[model samples]
Target: MEWLPHAQRLAREVVRPESRWYSAVATVPRHTYVPRWWEADGDVWILRDGQSNPDAWLKNVYKDTTLVTRVDTCHADTAGIEGIGIISDGTPTSSSTLPSLVVRMYRHAMIADDHQILVTTGTGYGTALACARLGSDHVTSVDVDEWLVNIAQDRLSLMGERPRVEVCDITGPLPGEYDRIVATVSVPRVPVSWLQALRRGGRFVTTLAGTGLILTADKTADGGAVGRIEWDRAGFMPTRHGADYEHPADDVWKGAMEGEGEATSTSRYPLLYPPDAWDVMSMLALTLPGIDYRHSQDGDTRTVWLLHPDGSWARARASGFLDSPAVHQSGPRRLWDELERIRHRLNREGALPVYGAQARVDPEGTLTLSRGAWSMTVN
Candidate 1:
């Protein structure tokens, strides 16, 4: 379609022409792979088809935006008109990640010529770009969903590019070893199997689950890996073992948000959700894992909820600008106080050292992170 040239031109604006990947981004027909996809309008998800609105479809594909192709296994390709429109009531399960972010991850990989690579096959748009830059023979892509793998393989074949696409859980045994591994999916921690599959001296890039931190590290001789967190931030859906993600028990969620805590106090700082602040969010997630954050607003009243699986939950509510938050802490730990402590520590230092920090993974998936005298571990 005529969209290729326009997409190439648009990509040039974001991905420099001098970049080795520019040509691949310029040539690959991304719209074909996302002929049907979901787009969120307000709080509802709506389906958009290339054949129905070719112009809007072309505009979307060429804009370097992510296209949602699947919602909890209800593939857009097969979704029929339901309710009043073509919509699905499922959370996004897979998408063609934004092209700019896709290339940005590749840029972090610092891939060298002749380096064999393994990458996640989301919508195959990124895989097509990779195959165009590095020959199909040197690139291997995988996805846990067999249907996605098959669709991507066929699409890539139609484009006259062929990469070994496999259906396998990336967290488990890899299809093969390579010098570079880049994942668009977030992992809770560095998977030990990745350590086993990576060739010594090979490097990998990924985002930690529940945060925007992007990490890149090389395999070490001790079956561990060490690297630095990139200053740039990116977030992705965590890899799914099945069609949907498992949620915390309904009662656990209810208690965390509504139940009373053992200790009640006022917060030094106003209520804030950790995910809103890139600087402290990663630090919070790394230091204390398994905390789910939620934010709600009622007029001037803003409430933030921090719920943990261990029956520990914190709720902070504030009104107006910069008002002190009424903090409630219950269960085994005081989470709101912990948030204040973390924020205070970072505020005292002028900035958190998450960027350019040294990251080390032990043999069993324990991540030891340190920058200057500040250090934290996540298992």
Candidate 2:
């Protein structure tokens, strides 16, 4: 099994040539940690096991792609045997994240030869890579899921790169202080505890929840950090407090899908999919936190939907590519108008001002993002 060589080649394409972690990326066997995984087949998720299909498994494992190892509380390794088509639905709770993105976050951390770092332990593949690069003594990995921590600890011990792998809530008190902190999971905002835990001059990197906005900052003497959102994009699942994430109720889902209208209007532009346009999406996610978005298209017709926790829901549809969508919104707030306001600014500015913009985290955990005169706060 010369999968190591193929994995190394994939690394060269994703990681910058100057990265010192290249050897770590090359040496770690990603497949060992993700022997069985879940992948979507049409609308259903199918379990893929390596023992039954080693060749296809090897090919998928070597490529820079996320492998879902657990759905809710079900670990793919223990779920069943080869190619089980699960007709039921389960949200993905854990995965071996794409290697390129993990390395990107590591590079963003500006890891030194001596700096201790704390990172998330997903399937333990990333922890293994970090341990190889920074040595097990300098690496401390934590996760909120006890099962994840237990599984990752056993795997890391097998590789002989055992660091302090703990089942600690990453949003809560950390097990120890470190010079660098990089999280694969997105947080609502920079945790106040993280600032207290970071050594002075320590750097932190993580994404903002609901958007692919990756923020990095250095710990300041004022107890808050300052930095800019990188032009590079990255995203991961939100941090959960329990075995599974909270979802909207069945009635709520129905209302969000097709609720009665409070206000209605013609859209100014073609209904845009937020994920397709990152800048507009960033502004939308920041301005309107907890907005659930969905989109679909059929031939020439396109549809967009928005749902807010405040009982606001919106649906817009366009008959042609260039046509403006007719929007029908329900609930307290006009969600579609918010999107238009962001889209209008994006249309005028030619770029969302998130990149290279100044960001400040106050001691109380208020995050202020400013560019030129435009400013927004997340508290």
Candidate 3:
């Protein structure tokens, strides 16, 4: 399609140099994998297809963005050749992750041509880039869905290159040893299986489940890999064994949103909406692990909810677009206080040390980060 040139331009200008990975962004046809797609609108996935409006699809596809290709592992192919039908209703199980994010993760991966690498293959676009840079023989790409693997294999073959495209869950035992392993998907923990499959001195890059932290570490002789956060923030769909992510606690958001009942506490810091873009949120997550945030905006009121695994939660709301907000919190830990503390550290020190921090992982899966005298341990 004529749109290919535009996609190439966006890839070259936005994703290539910024991420420093091989420019598969220009080579792989992202539109082909996403002939029809969906976007999250509130609680539902709104189906959008190329055939209906080629102009709109062209613009959306080439914007250096991610399109949800499938939901609940149901391929968009079920909607017929033109990609029209009932929009599948469920969480996004897989996608061609945004090109910028893909490149960023690859940059964090620090892959070299001589090192054999294992990478997660979904739409196979990432695998194509790996094969292009490292040679097909040096890259082993695996995915849990055989159909995805097969389609990706065909796509790669069309380009005169073929890496080992196989149907295997990335969280399990990999087929071969490699000096580098990069997972496009997030995982609950550094899958022990990955550490076991990595050769000594190998490096692995992945994201922690439900967080935007990119964990990069090198495989050790003791079988554990040690590394630190890349200092850049990234997010990916969590890894799944079969198809979809394990369901989160039902009504978890519902209960928190309703403001059923709770004791109140003064927040140690000012609350911010959409913490994903805030460096302090990342720092707070690292400093006080297991805290998650949710935000809601309805008419004049904007509310933010913080939930932790330790049964701690905080709800803050502001009216009339005021600069300050009223907050209420409960549980064993002062969640917002911790966030404010992190923000205070950032304010005083000029920046948090997460970026460019050093990491080390022992054989037992314990991960440690160090920057001067400040250190944090993650398991």
Candidate 4:
């Protein structure tokens, strides 16, 4: 397969020619790590096989885009020929992260040649890139799924680079200490285990679940870590303890989708998809954590729903982007009102406090995010 030129082009797009990671980006065969992947078409996931169409495979593999290799617990590599139809259920569990984002995470770590790094193994493509730059001995990769780890190790060995790949839950006790620990998966909070595994003064970089905040911190002397919410935002799938993520109960969503809540009002602002706005979503998550955001469009109308596990729900319907959404709220809390308060803050201050906020993780894994006088403690 003539894939070197494509990789070289990808390298140029993601890194400078003089950068240490440039060669790794230019040389690693990303396609080898993702022979088959799931591509989304509207609400359904369609399987794409590289062997069936080499041209499309090269196009997707070389592009600076993420490819979902596993949906729920079903890996595309093992999905066989029968898994080509539209799959509307379940969520993506594993993916080959975009090359640029992988490089961005590595850059955040300020990885030195001598620094040992622990990274997550998704498609093993990121692991391969790390091995190419820092050598297999300096890199250690871990994944929760045994099959994922086994296949990744085999691929790494085939490339003549065998790093330590283990089937371990990254949120739990790590296998060893390292100078840098970078997680491509987001977590609800900084795990105490991560702090314990990091060598003193080591750096850690990862995203927070339910938000698009990329946090970068350094281990402090007191067995804790201090850092800031980075201005650059990236979102990754939240870490799971088992084969798949535990979704909210169906009854919770039922109220949000069907019921006319206890209160109804017209929103002062237009309908905004929370996920599409990183800062807004981050502030909402910080203020009212555990709100599940959902949105759908029918013809010219757009409807947004916010469901909480505590039975609180909110729905907003708008005919146009600039039109005021008719909002409804139910349960013990006024969820839409809370969202409006956030929007009001943004309108009044021109910015949200989530980005660039100071972050501190206690030894017990509690995280506090503060900006100016505003503070939020996440346990």
Best-matching candidate per lDDT: 4
lDDT (10s digit) by residue, model 2, range 232-306: 888799888888887752334576565557777898787688888877777888988887887778899888888
The top-ranked prediction according to TM-score is: 4
Candidate 1 runs further than 4 Å off: 81-90
By lDDT, highest first, what's the ranking? 4, 2, 1, 3
What does the lDDT read for residue 146 in candidate 1?
A: 87
Model 4 score (lDDT): 0.91
* Local distance difference test values of all predictions, in order: 0.84, 0.85, 0.74, 0.91
Total clashing pairs for each candidate = 1, 0, 7, 0
Candidate 3 Cα misplacement greater than 4 A, ranges:
15-23, 79-90, 158-160, 287-290
TM-score of each: 0.94, 0.95, 0.85, 0.97
RMSD values, in order shown: 2.0, 1.8, 3.2, 1.2
**Ten-residue segment with the worst summed lDDT in candidate 2?**
248-257
Candidate 1 lDDT by residue in tens digits, 86-160:
444567889999999999999999988798999999889989989999989989999998889999999999999
- lDDT (Cα, tens digit) per residue for candidate 3, span 1-379: 5866866786776664545353567666666656777777767777777878988878887777787777885676454564554454477888877777877777777887688888888777778778766789898899898878888888788877778878998888789888888998887667788888888888899987656778888887778776777667777887778766554433345555656436665454455753654566666766666567777888877788888766677778776465466777766776766766776787799987767778877776777778888887777
Give a tens-digit lDDT track for model 4, residues 210-238.
99999999999999999999889998998
Candidate 2: regions farther than 4 A off: 81-84, 87-89, 249-251
Candidate 1 vs 3: which has more lDDT: 1
